[model samples]
Target: MAVEMEEKPVIKLAAICGSLRKASYNRGLLRAAMKMCRDSVIEGIEMEDIDISELPMMNVDLESNGTFPLVVEEFRHKIRGCDAVFFASPEYNYSLTPLLKNAIDWASRPPNAWADKPAAIVSVEGSGKSGQYHLRQIGVFLDIHFINKPELFLNAFEPPKKFDDNGDLIDEETRKRLQDVLLALRAFTLRLMKGKSY
Candidate 1:
């Protein structure tokens, strides 16, 4: 009998965190999502090198200068190279964070990195619904095929500190919800990669 090795799907995921706060709930949500999906069909991306804050505003004139900002180029490249994107956002004053929005603004120019890509949103904050709605608005203009089900809205302010310094999901229920979302997102990406429309 011959032993055969299983092949893993080459799923490149670009995770963007909306908040730049040192202890942002949104970043923690991404961490939770990655941990929960370790055994799933898709691989989670840890974009630790990219700085969302350094991408500057959406200025075409500035972009047309001598050189493009490394952060902007890297962000667009990540989105273009990846099969899907997972946005970990926080609702600040009932809207998406500025840090994440600016990064998206820069990436959605000229070539539009998010044009027709499969994407998912996760928000961990006091009001999860608010974050979700706000993020949806951005999804509309970017032309991102946002996932409609298995939403992960972690209520961090309620009970059980669901994250620590490194943004790890501490609660069991929250982890389960993140896992469910990842599973759905994995299937979503795979289907999209296979040329299937959702």
Candidate 2:
């Protein structure tokens, strides 16, 4: 007897963080996201593997030279290759951290790569409210089809401690939140891919 197989939808997601620190809460949140994503429609790409520190800021000379920094080029290529993005950002003085902002700036240069992509934000901070506003501002400017429902904010740094060093999510509440965001993001990504507003 032959068995039928389920068709898995290909949904690529590029994840970025607001901190370069090895132990950053934002990166921890990204790890949680990776844990939650479904195998059927999720492919999570972390930014750490792509070196962005070598890339210069969005400068005229860089473009004029017709040269693409391997890191920046990989960044844009990932964005272009993906169906959506998941930004795991930390709050810095009630704003998105500079590390994440620089990433956006670099990706949004002339010949932008972020336009019209469906995106979502999952912020982890000592205080959740502050991160909300910060992500809102970024969503507005990026023109991404930001998922409005099931917004996630890991308010306290303590929650991530439930997970192990291997980046597994252990806290029940945090795990549930991760599931909620993935479902919401999947719906949002599907809506955007279908050319419908959600």
Candidate 3:
């Protein structure tokens, strides 16, 4: 007699980078996480990035008609459909970048898409941990369920070797931490789906 093996559901995660620069280290870190997910390192998980650069600044004037821009709508749709979120923040002026804030503002409007979704944050910063802190504060208002352990606070400046010359994340230790964060996020999301609280 052959026993049937139960199949695990594929968890979809959406990643957002807080920087728009072409050579942003935060983006590189995000890419590394994505590559790991693509390689099936996380088991039954898929990850993709939703670009926030195209989102226009949050302006109430633009929403006078009670409609979000096409790009903003698309962003909200992606977040709403994903099982979890991953944010790679690059500290700017001791805080999250305006680009990322704008994207969040758009999504936090009516029918908040970020609500109840398990989230994780990683940052490539010099010394300021404010960016991650600010993200967590915002998560409170957005009702985002974030994994609080194993926070990835990588210092790209003082590191012996964080990224390669090509801006790819080459540090094995950091990569391992990122993988752990993703795994935690996967478990966290599954728990929430099963009506369990963190």
TM-score of each: 0.83, 0.79, 0.93
lDDT of 2 by residue, 1-198 (tens): 999985535567777766777766567777766755544233433222234555566665666465467778888887878787877777788788776777788888767788888877877667746765766776678777788878887765563465555444567787677667877776777667666434
Candidate 1 lDDT, 34-110, residue by residue in tens: 65455442354333324576777877777755345777787788788877888888788888777877888887887
Candidate ranking under lDDT, highest first, comes to: 3, 1, 2
Off by over 4 Å in 2: 1-8, 38-54, 65-67, 157-168, 196-198
Best by TM-score: 3
User: Of 1 and 3, which scores higher on TM-score?
Assistant: 3
What tens-digit string does per-residue lDDT give for candidate 3 at 1-198?
Answer: 999996667889999998877788899989998888888787878888899888888887777566787888889999999999999988888788888999999999888999988999999888879889988999999999889998999888875788987779888988899999988998888878767433
Steric clash pairs (candidate 3): none
Clashing pairs in 1: none
lDDT of each: 0.74, 0.69, 0.88
